[model samples]
Target: MPRSATDLLDLSELPAPQRREVRDFVQFLLTRQAGAKKPAASYRFSDLCGTMAWKGDAVAAQRSLRDEW
Candidate 1:
């Protein structure tokens, strides 16, 4: 029978160096997959956005609060 893509690995058959190489490749693929995920839409946070926009110097107010902390 043909082995499925998810067939069990026989790491014991691989040389130590080859096993390390395979492990590194798997990690690389996982990292690439994580970064390839689509970002959320620009309007995803639209509702919570303008909720914090005030007319005054919000940056100065934030700095002052941070200094107090």
Candidate 2:
């Protein structure tokens, strides 16, 4: 049998309600993936896409500078 990432994520040890929560959260994350370089995700209270912008390594370097420290 082939094992996908989600097949193992559905741990049988978890309770029914907890299992449902896990399933829903996983689906939510899949939907949130906006085909960007960043792995950032946010929840939407309203029916709107929580935008994810991917500013790459330049931002990280700036943040790590002495002035930022």
Candidate 3:
């Protein structure tokens, strides 16, 4: 509920280990924010979509999959 960084935490009053935990949490937030600001990596599945060539009978394949054999 703190409005500013200075008011956000009393790191001085925290034990050293707890202070380190806060520092780590802040670092994680910063890194997460940085990642959010950037565009995500893209993937191109189109190139691999139809790369495999099927030589068998198409209708037979469909029927077999339906347990219609």
lDDT tens per residue, model 3, 1-69: 547443467899889998888878887887899899999979777666856678999998998999964
Error of 1 at 55 (Å): 33
- Which scores better on TM-score, 1 or 2? 1
Give the clashing residue pairs of candidate 2, or none.
none
- Candidate number with the higher lDDT (1 or 3): 3
**lDDT of each candidate versus the true structure:** 0.74, 0.72, 0.80
- Residue 63 alpha-carbon offset, candidate 1, angstroms: 48
Specify the highest-TM-score model's number: 3
lDDT of each residue in 1-69, candidate 2, tens digit only: 896446767479999888888888877777676455576678675557566666778767777895675
Task: Return the clash pairs for model 1, or none.
Answer: none
What residue runs in model 2 are displaced by over 4 Å at the alpha carbon?
Answer: 1-4, 34-69
TM-score for each model: 0.42, 0.40, 0.53
Cand. 3 TM to true fold: 0.53
Worst 10 residues of 3 by lDDT: 1-10
CA lDDT for candidate 3: 0.80
Between prediction 2 and prediction 3, the one with superior TM-score is 3
Across residues 1-50, which tens digit of lDDT does each residue of candidate 1 receive? 99632245677788999977887787788788877896755665756775
